[model samples]
Target: MKAMRLEAIGKLFVREVEKPVPGSEDLLVRVEACGICGTDRHLLHGEFPSTPPVTLGHEFCGIVEVVGEAVKGFKPGMRITGDPNISCGLCPQCQAGRVNLCANLKAIGISRDGGFADYVIVPQKQAFDIPLTLPPEHGAFCEPLACCLHCIDMARIKAGSSVIVLGGGVIGLLTVQLARLAGATTVILSTRQESKRRLAEELGATASFDPSEDDPIGGLAGLKGLLPGGADVVIECAGVRETVMQAPKLAKSGGTVVILGVLAQGEKVEIEPFDILFRELRLIGSFINPHTHRRAADLVASGKINVEKLISRKITLDEAPETIRNPARAGEIKVLVMAGT
Candidate 1:
């Protein structure tokens, strides 16, 4: 089996490795497609906490090459995606249905071997059969779409509500569509990528702003007049500190601010205590998903979410390293690493 090993910070290489076997409750999946995430870069730079000598790729899907004993509803040939956030069902957070915050959580790409390889193991409970009707490449998007779904769930956007998405990366674009589906009447997108903004407009955004050239918060006044108060929710999907700090300011008084992006570990952004008190804003943080992955898979499989337009490039496993190294490659947004591409 060929696996891309992250032996240490600032290093990765493809190596021939022994294939893995599954436990009685596990399934061995042959990798088909994996999405390279920004966190992968963070892991490579030691900006995030990850055990060294690990293979890094969590957003992936594949066909079941072999099923361990007692793994039901799955056969050797079944195509599937799964919840990568492995949790101890006995933990307090897990018992409370907040498995994303479980004390004993072990993620596939972070803590164990992930899908950037020929074969990877997953617990049967976390694995879901990909709807056969959809293409395998789209199935690869299941995990990321699920993560965005979890973020949208945190906002609780009301119908006709005003919403803003900070950032136009893969997650930001996905968040725009979900905000529209939640019945938001006004969707404002802030991003520097002109190409991404155009795509966002085609999807559902009422207007797109280039935050690099102009102030995004300047438009909030008009958005406030459009809404009953202002934007009912602001979703910070950009992991940068500037965007994180701007989220609450973009919202109107009493509006909710959902911090959905994964900031680098130990990173901090300054915020005044008086601002929270004066605005009476709700500052909520959305971490990894809880249990919305299946719903996300269904949403994408059913064609309600138009993410195909968000995919800007497709490559094989051999191209993964270069893709990770150069993010500005010709309007790249959600580059799909299809098997044998």
Candidate 2:
């Protein structure tokens, strides 16, 4: 089997490795497609915490080749999406139903061998079934969509509510659709790329803004801006310093700001505590997909979310190391690594 191994920080390569076997409760998944995430780049640059000498792909979907004896309700030839985050059931956070914040958490691709290979092992508890009739590439979206679902849940969007999504990447674009589905009437997206801005509007953003061209904080949240008094909810999805800092200011006095982006581990950004205090704003940080993977799979299977448009490129595993090494191409949304390609 072949895998893209992160030998160490700043070291990544396509290496031939022995195939993995499933445990009593695990399934051996033949990697079909895995999406390259910003976190992959972060992991490569040591901007994020990850176990080196491991495969680096978390957003993945595949076909079941071998099922463990202890696994039930799943069989060979089934298509499924894997939830990478595994929380210790005995942890305080898990007992309180806050699994994402569990004291002991190990994620696939980050801590273990992942889907950027010919085969990856997934525990029965981590796999969600998706229809075989759907395009394999779309299955790769389930993981990211699940994370976005958590962000939407945190945003608490309501009917007629206004939302401002910072960054027009896959996360931001998916969020725009989810916000609309969540009953937000005014959905806006802000990004520097003109192509992404246009795509965001096509994907249900009521409007899009280019921060590089105009001041986003003023153009979108100003008194005379798009949303007169600011948006009801502002989601920072760019995972950059500027967008993170602008999130709170883009919200109305009583609006909510959800940080759904993943900045570098030690990256710092200054925010105004007094402003939050005065406005009574709700500022939150949304982590990875906690309990939303199943719903994300269902949404993808049902064809409600347009995962197709979000796919910018599809490449072979051989191309993955370089793709993860370099920055995303101009206006690129999501790139998937097709195993058999």
1-341 in candidate 2: lDDT tens per residue?
A: 89999999999999999999999999999989999999999999999888899998999999999998999999999999999999999988899999999888999999999999999999999999998999999999999999999999988899999999998889999999999999999898988888998998888999887777766556555633577678899999999998999899889999999999999998899999999999999999999999999999999999999999999999999999999888999989999999777
lDDT tens per residue, model 1, 185-287: 8998988889988999999999888877756555444554434355789999989899998888778898899998888889999987798899999999988
After best superposition, candidate 1 residue 87: deviation in angstroms?
Answer: 0.5
In model 1, the Cα lDDT at residue 214 comes to 57
User: Total backbone clashes of model 2?
Assistant: 0
List lDDT for all candidates, in order. 0.83, 0.93
- Structural similarity to truth (TM-score) of each candidate: 0.95, 0.98
Stretches > 4 Å off in candidate 2: 220-225
Tell me the deviation in Å of residue 136 in model 1.
1.1
lDDT of 2: 0.93
